[model samples]
Target: MSTTTTLEAPNTGTWDGGNEPMKASYGKLMMWFFLLSDAFTFGAFLIVYGLARHKHMPYTGKADDFTFSTEWWPIPEKVYNAFPGLHGMDLPLAFVALMTMILILSSVTMVLAVEAGNRMDKNDVQKWLLWTILFGATFLGCQAWEWTHFITGTEEGMLLADGTRIFGANLTMNQYGPPLFADLFFFITGFHGTHVLSGVVLLIMIFINTVNGVYHKRGHYEMVEKVGLYWHFVDLVWVFVFTFFYLI
Candidate 1:
């Protein structure tokens, strides 16, 4: 009798389609790529804004008494002093600070939802997702209010070089500092607000799916984790925007 010896295949130390690629699912990897591209877009916008800001002269007037002019950039504290339902009070960065806090709270709730998903606790996931949606909506509402105030401009208004007084901001003219400032503000903040709105819509859909047992039936909650990634990215971008636009 002749015996034949069998040889085992050698390990190549490479992904062979036997598990998730790079230890992450295809969906997750795609989401990351999309976010990376988005980050580049935001970065470009901010970089352009920075270049433009550097080309202008800085405001040297007192925050409370600064007058708008094309000769110099308006102080952020002076321009953003208005607060909702509290006129005649100089509350610089107050509303935006509240908006940032709300966004941060939403991120926290999203974390809770992701954790609940890990535990496969559908009820907890649903509860946390609902809170996250609520917070996102609140942030959007605050943004709308801020935009309205910015468009309406200040009651004092600004006197133009043409011997005419103007109030509020438009795409062409703004009562606050250089026209470029308003242009950048509208573009950047509006872009970020659009992202937040999209996030709120996605969260609502995710909440619905969770309520319908969609993820539960699938035996995994990866969908929640994916959206959580996006939510966190939005919150992080807002922090940068807040710093660049308001604080510094």
Candidate 2:
């Protein structure tokens, strides 16, 4: 007697999006997807910036010797050489360096907040989150100052070919080098700044919730982790922006 056994159908429930992949929660996975998409957007913007900069050769001279010219790309150091208190000084990248430090420190505080969240320490979470917010606000203030200086420009100003004397950078003209430089600067930096602002708002929300014991009642701090991911991403993007837009 030959008995044939029938094979049962494979279980489809696990594959029906019912189970979390890689042991990650649905919310965490969704956050990753969103971040991946955002990365692509930022990557495209940076790539375009790189290609455009490559197409136009940057000035290969001293910052002091550099002149305003649309024909060639302006050196970043020459363009961003204004200091706050010490006006008229040729401190290239000083203010930007400070901004970078402030942002990085904010990222550090964010990490601490996430760690505290993971440990279920609500007090520490609130403390670190507040620090992160303060640092982020400081960074934004620095950026505002930088923008003001960039717009106000040097007292000497640049004389255009058409007998127009412009002080700083605007959409139509740039005292630095090419108008394209200023355009990309505003768009890219402005986009990043908006992200920072959003992150700060989110942090404030999380801080309020923590103070009110919302996450404590829920028994998990996953919300903090999600915002932490976003904060870290913003900080990481700035590093690249500083490298490409400033140092390069």
Candidate 3:
């Protein structure tokens, strides 16, 4: 009867609100909400991409506009080259792969910075944050290289007027994929890169704050912790991107 009553009666609410929080300040709360919204935005984009990839296969723009119509999208392995280093190399997803590693590493460094902040260790914080910044810069450089490779033709063929696809020197109608596939690749990766760039700028701001002793003067460096959360969230987004765009 007590169990039945507990189940049937109006449920009591949490005293602190609908759910317990992570004992964060208002800034951290806002960051969590912001990350949640950003997550939904990226999720919707990937879902749409998946739907398209399943529905319409792309064409191979080769021999001055080789075209193919199909029931699915271009396999990503066919696209995304790096540069002169990987001439005629299959996949050439190495740059993006390296990019993923750097991003994950930067997230680790950011966490360390937060730890240092908690301990009020300014030198430790600066050192780790510098490493984080360097990793971020490296990721950006790799991204730029990828974009450059896409823009210029390698030993393989070049893109169509659509500016979204590429072809090997001998891409057949049945072999090469669609122009739209290229389009989506550039669009999706570019958007994610922009986010990374934004994160870098924010990181710089926090770095400046630390250097200026803003947090130290205030007696706590929770700002570093909050920013670290954002950095980690960006890295998490890349994991899903790599799985869907590369490994899968």
Q: What is the TM-score of each candidate against the true structure?
A: 0.91, 0.91, 0.77
- lDDT for each residue of candidate 2 in 1-248, tens digit (9 for 90 to 100): 65998897656687775565589888888888998998888898899899889999767777577787777897787788887899889888999999999999999999999999999999999999999999999999999999998887888787778998778898888887778888889889999999999999999999999999999999999999999999999999999999999998
Model 1: per-residue lDDT, tens digit, 26-113? 9999999999999998998899889999999988766666788988988888888888999979898889889999999999999999
What ranges in model 2 sit over 4 Å off?
1-12, 61-64
lDDT of each structure? 0.92, 0.90, 0.74
**Which digits, one per residue and each the tens of the lDDT, describe model 3 over residues 1-248?**
35554445554577735454577678989999999999998898789778877676444355234322333454455555444475676655666777888998999999999999999998899899989989988898888777666645455454455665544312232223454555565767777888889888988998998999998999999988988998898899889989888766
CA error at residue 226 for candidate 1, angstroms: 0.2
The local lDDT score (0 to 100) that residue 82 gets in candidate 1 is: 83
Q: Determine which window of 10 residues in candidate 2 has minimal summed lDDT.
A: 12-21
After superposition, candidate 3 runs with Cα above 4 Å error: 1-22, 58-72, 81-84, 158-176
Error of 2 at 75 (Å): 0.8
- What TM-score does structure 2 among the candidates reach? 0.91
